[model samples]
Target: MRLGQRLRTIADMVPIGVTMADIGTDHAYLPIYLVEQKIITSAIAGDIHQGPYLSAKNAVAAVQLTQHISVRLGNGLEVVKPGEAEVVVIAGMGGANIIDILNSRPEVTSKVKRLILQPMIAAALVRTWLHTQGWQIVDEQLVQEEGKLYQIIAAEPGGSPVVEPVLYEIGPLLWQSKHPLLKLHINELIGHLRGVILAMEGSADAVKLAKYREYTIRLKALEEKIRCL
Candidate 1:
C-alpha cells in the first residue's frame, strides 16, 4: 500500500515490532502499510464513522491481514484496552480534540508506551497538554504536503516538570534542535502575525490595539529566533 508523505512520515515514527492502535483511522492505510512492511506485528484499526469503519474492514480483508489487523468501530481510544497496544496513534484531528480523546480514557492512555499525534491545527495546545500530562515529546517532524505544512509529534511517559509557554508556541524539540524546517515554519508564523498586525493597525478598539501590540512583540521575537538559527 502506498502512503502519502504525511502518513508515511507518521508510520516511520512507529517503532518496529510494537503493537499499535490507530485511532480515527479513516481508511486504515497506516496500519495496513505498517503490517504489510512487517514493521509492526499487529495493529487495531479503529474508526468512529460507519463509512470509514466498513472501508477499514474491507481494506484489511483485501490485504489478507485479517488475523494481524483488527478493524474496530468505536470513538477515539475506547475500542482498545490497556496492555493491548504498546503505542497509540491519533492523527488527522485538531489538537483540542486529540486532548479530549486522551483525557476521555486516561486509564488506557496511561498504560500505553507511547503516543504519536498529528494535530491538524492548534498544535501548540497539544504540546502544552502533553507536558502537563507528563508525556515527553521525544521527536517531531515537519513536512509540506500538497502545499500545506504538517507537524507530527511523538511523545512518551515521563516529561519535563516545567511547561513553558514559549516551548508550546515554538515547539520545544523543534526549536531546541533547530530542525531544518523550523526556520521556514517560523517565517510562516511571522508572516501570519504581520498580517494580523496590519489588519489591526487602524482599529480604535482597545482590545484590537492590545492584540496588535502583542503580535508585534511576538513577530519580532520570532524573527530574532530565526536569525539566531
Candidate 2:
C-alpha cells in the first residue's frame, strides 16, 4: 500500500518485527502497510469515532488482513491492553491532545517500547512532555506534504531533559542534524510569531501585553537561530 509523505515518514520510524498500535488511525493505512510489508507482525488500529473504526475494518478486510490487524472503536490508547503492542503511534493530532492520550493511560504507555508522534500544532508541548517523562528523542524527521510541513518525533525510554527552551520549540535533534527543512520550519515559526505580535500591537490588556512580550522574545530567538542556519 502506498502511504502519503507524512504517514510514510512515521511508518519508517517503526522498528521491524514489532506489535504496533495506531491511535486515531483514519483508515488503518499505516498499520496495513506495515503488516503487509512484514514490518510489524500484527497491529491494533484504533479510533474514537465509529466512522473511522468501520472504515478501518473495511480497509483491513479489503486487503485480507483481518487476521493480522484488529480495528477497534475507542478513544486514544484505550483500545489496546498493557504489553499488547511494542510500539504506539499517535499522529495527525494536536500536541495537547496527544499528550492527554498518553497521560490518560500511563500503564499502557509505560510498557510500550517506543512512541512515534506527529503533532499538528504546538509540537513544543509534545517535546516537553517527552523530556519530562524521561523519553529521549531518538530521532526526528521533517516532511512537507501539500504545502504544509509536519514534524515526526520518535522517542524511547531513558532520554535526557532538554535544557534550552527554544530547543524544545525547534527539536533538539532537528537542530543538531540541521535537517533540510529546519530553516524553513524556523522561518515558518518566525512568520507565525510575527503575525501574532502584529495582531496584538497596541493592546493595553495586561494578559495580551504579557503574551506579546513572550512572543517577541520567542520571535527573536527564532530569528537568531535562522541566521545561524
Candidate 3:
C-alpha cells in the first residue's frame, strides 16, 4: 500500500520495531503501510466515527492484517490502553484538537515513548503544548501535497522548554534544519499577518488596536526571519 507524501513523512518519523497506535486513523492506511514495511509488528488503528472505524476495519481485513492490527472505534487516546503502544500518531487534525486529545488522556500520552503529530492549522499551539508538557521536539518536516503544505512534528519525553516565542510558531527544528520550505512558510505567515494588520488599520476599539499591534510585531519578526533566510 502507498501513502501520500504527508502520511509518508509522518510514517518516516516512526522508529522501527515499535508498537504504534494511530489516532484518527481514518482508513488505517498509515498503520497498514507500516506493518507491510515491517516497521512495526503490532498497531492499533483508532477512529472516532463509525464510517472511518468500519473503513479501517475493512481495510485491515482486506489486507489480511487483522491479526497484527486492531481497529477500534473510540475518541482520541481512549482507544488504546496505557503502555500499549510505543509511538502514538495523530494526524490530519487541527493543532488545538491534537492538543486536546493529548490533554484528554494523560495516562496514555505520558507512557508513550514518542508522538508523531501532523496538525493542519494552528501548529504553533501544538508546539507550545508539547513544550509546556516537556516533550522535546526531535524532528520536524514539511511536505507539500496538492498545493497545500503540511507540518509534521515528532517529539519525545524530556526536553527543555522553548525560550523564544516565535520559534513555537515557526518550528525551531524546521528553522535550525533550514528546511527547503522555510522561506515559503515564512512568506505565507507574513502575508497572512499583513492581511490581518491591514484589516484592523482603522479600528478604534482598544482590543482590536492591541491585537493589531501584536500582529504588527509578529509581522516584523517574520520579515526579519525571511531576510535572514
Among these predicted structures, which one has the highest lDDT? Answer: 2
Tell me the RMSD of model 2 versus the true structure: 1.1
What does candidate 3 score on TM? 0.96
Per-model TM-score, in order, reads 0.90, 0.97, 0.96
Candidate number with the higher TM-score (2 or 3): 2
- The top-ranked prediction according to TM-score is 2
Give lDDT tens digits, candidate 2, residues 1-229: 9999999999999999999999999899999999999999999999999998999999999999999999999999999999999999999999999999999999999999999999999999999999999899999999999999999999999968546788899999999999999999999898888888887775667436667778888888888889997
- Shift in Å, residue 36, candidate 3: 0.5
Tens-digit lDDT track of model 1 for 1-229: 9999999999999999999999999889999999999999999999999999999999999999999999999989899998889999999999999999999998899889989999988888899899888989998889889998888999999957674455576788889888888988888877877887777776677435666777777788777777888
The digit string of per-residue lDDT tens for model 3 on 1-229 reads: 9998999999899999999999999999999999999999899999999999999999999999999999999999999999999999999999999999999999998899999999998998999888889999999998999998889999999876555777787899999999999988888788887887776775667336667777888888888888897
Ranking of predictions according to lDDT: 2, 3, 1
- After superposition, candidate 1 runs with Cα above 4 Å error: 161-164, 197-203, 206-217
Predict model 1's lDDT versus the native. Answer: 0.89
- Model 1 residue 3 lDDT? 97
Query: What is candidate 3's CA lDDT for residue 197?
Result: 76
